[model samples]
Target chain A: MIDLSQTISSNTIVYTLDMVGVAACTIAATILAKRLQFDVLGAFFVSFLGSVGGGTLRDLLLNRHPIFWLHDLNYIHFIIGLSLIVQIFYHYVERLDKALRWFDALGLAAFTVIGVESALSRNMSAPIVMLMGVFTAIIGGVFRDIVCRQIPLVLQKEIYITASLVGSVYYLLLLQTGINEWLRSISTLLLIFSVRMLAVYRGWNLPDITLQPKEKQK
Target chain B: MIDLSQTISSNTIVYTLDMVGVAACTIAATILAKRLQFDVLGAFFVSFLGSVGGGTLRDLLLNRHPIFWLHDLNYIHFIIGLSLIVQIFYHYVERLDKALRWFDALGLAAFTVIGVESALSRNMSAPIVMLMGVFTAIIGGVFRDIVCRQIPLVLQKEIYITASLVGSVYYLLLLQTGINEWLRSISTLLLIFSVRMLAVYRGWNLPDITLQPKEKQK
Candidate 1:
């Protein structure tokens, strides 16, 4: 009997994690778009764009070849598939705000860990990596809100990007202390998820700073 | 009197054109944002973003040092100045929609030429240069439209990016034929502006291709 051996690349694992996170974001974004009375095309735009927009920005900045979906065509197909499901049962998703919130937090946490680790692997400096991680984790939601004609929660000083930033720092500290890789990843995810959830539940928001109206705001 | 002599940088003309193109885009975006009823903050965001966002994206892709604004802080002040002036005279701007449309067309034309030229200078393939031109010219407007909660004209068949693409082709052909550099640039801009104005006046639009309501759209 002949046996075939296969090894999964760490990149593959990271890619899969990103896909899962994006799927969760897509579902949440579709629900939000519907609640806002976005048309069908608007819902699809919100979902797909909010899901992949950040990673696309990251890839463009890095000059990476074949953007994530362009590479794994399946990822695009997956989003399309998920969008259809949401479209079919729009009422059901609208009624599950609590579930969607939990899923969003989870997805945000997962993407934070994944983005920070990916940047680290590419040898980006800590500050840059942290920014990229946080941006990757939450810029999608910001973009969605912007397109929905609303102020982005991130800009308004919610504890959004801060949670991702803190989680990334924790991951780096663990790496410095020689913690097991698996443990560090889990810890980072938990750290981000808990901080974000607690912030939402406890009404903990970042202090909003005025930009001084340097240009004579009207 | 102290001598104020300075050595002219070899690439002064090239860099000057690039900045000029960016400034034009900034002014046009500010006008559009105003017409759309964006407050001072929103207008500033759209103006500054349209001006710097394209070059920033290009520099990031090339991993160049000192993003354009970082190297020359004047742009920050320039945008502030423009925003202040516009806000104070908001009434005048609102009365100049016809002039603003022409400025918008000019900005689009200028950015299209600059984008393709820069990519070509960097030794990118023609197709890549073409794509860059289209992206640089249209992305800012698309972003502005999206943020205003309006469907982006380019994403539809607005004949926007297509005009830029055609202009890029004309510029490349002019270069291939060894036409005068000034003529090449002017013709390219003229071609695009004329085409865009004609399209807008005639209500010309690209036919919308259905992605089909099947389980696939991403």
Candidate 2:
């Protein structure tokens, strides 16, 4: 006899949200592949890597078996389907570069919250958890950009990583206040998304940390 | 009282080999960072990634906790020390590019065997094990190259990926034959190293598989 009244757990919800982030990031990778004029296989490879890279690292660090994607085919299907759709509609995607940034920001936020919660669940220290959150939020895109031979936006003169760091730390602080779990997660997501979007809008960026003299600057 | 005579297993040997590989790859990464003219911090970051990226991914996929490096500070110390040495001897390294390739090949071989054995211990399928081995063999360099904004040599015209796949598959076949374990492992290491070196000497490479027409190819 199956228990019919069991509520879905927060872990499950976070997993679902992470998948959504993966899907969005996969789409972004596909678009980047198109821009790079990669072949179909290269495009698919980059998309898959972008979708799963961060979460895979998280699961590995946490010692989760089979990895998230390996346990189910849905993530793979989503990535492939989304990649194909993007390939067919790349012209439209070019016009929606702004929307792409928003989608990526949404993924970043969702991933950050999910990463934070997962690390917290594992009883990792707060700073480590927060950094894991930031790593999760940014590494997938970093992988994609690197594979495509572009400087990762996270390492560029941008506020992307800073936004993730702040959001994750904020979420951890909220957790200590005994707030409603769902509310706290939602707030974290919003905080990251909003900060990233504002950074994009306001052209916010960290000063260059290059060690070379002015003539050697790129 | 702790038992004094329980001999260190093959696992320990492979792990030590993997660490040696890590050190070699770290030096390679530091050299690459220098050629890229990264700052000191950037050089260290790249070196650390090259040292641990492959093993980290393998551990993650196999659900190993705390990761190998996290469990021991020695890996961290080795990376830092190697990075400093390479930084101080950057000019000497420039004159020894040939030696760098040899060290890299040795790392590739050792990492491949370790990765293969780890996956096999987890009862992964043969194909998956081989692929994981290849991933472990090449991914660190792939990462270092990608982060430095160079095309990953694995995906470039190099014969790198082929050698890994061959070495791993060969090692697995040897295991199935119930051969002496140390002999099997050492042979696999030698095979990969030899293949890679020969490919370099012979100027062997896979043909480009660009999907674009001649005029559009890069």
Query: Candidates' lDDT values, in order?
Result: 0.73, 0.80
TM for every model, in the order presented, reads: 0.56, 0.59
lDDT per residue, candidate 2, B3-28, as tens digits?
Answer: 43322556566877788799789888
Off by more than 4 A, model 2: A1-47, A54-64, A71-142, A151-218, B1-9, B36-42, B208-218
Task: In model 1, state the lDDT of residue A118.
Answer: 64
Q: What local lDDT does model 1 show for residue A98? A: 82
> How much is the lDDT of residue B69 in candidate 2?
85
Model 1, residue B15: distance off in Å is 7.4
Q: After superposition, how far is residue B104 of candidate 2 from its true place, in Å?
A: 1.1
Error of 1 at A4 (Å): 17
Candidate 1: global Cα-lDDT? 0.73
Candidate 1, residues B1-218, lDDT tens digits: the string is 64323223324534565566566666667777877878888889988877777766655644455776797887788877876687678788768778776777777787788778777766766766775686677666666666556655454445677678789988888878967666777788889999988888898765432233435444
* Model 1 lDDT at residue A39: 47
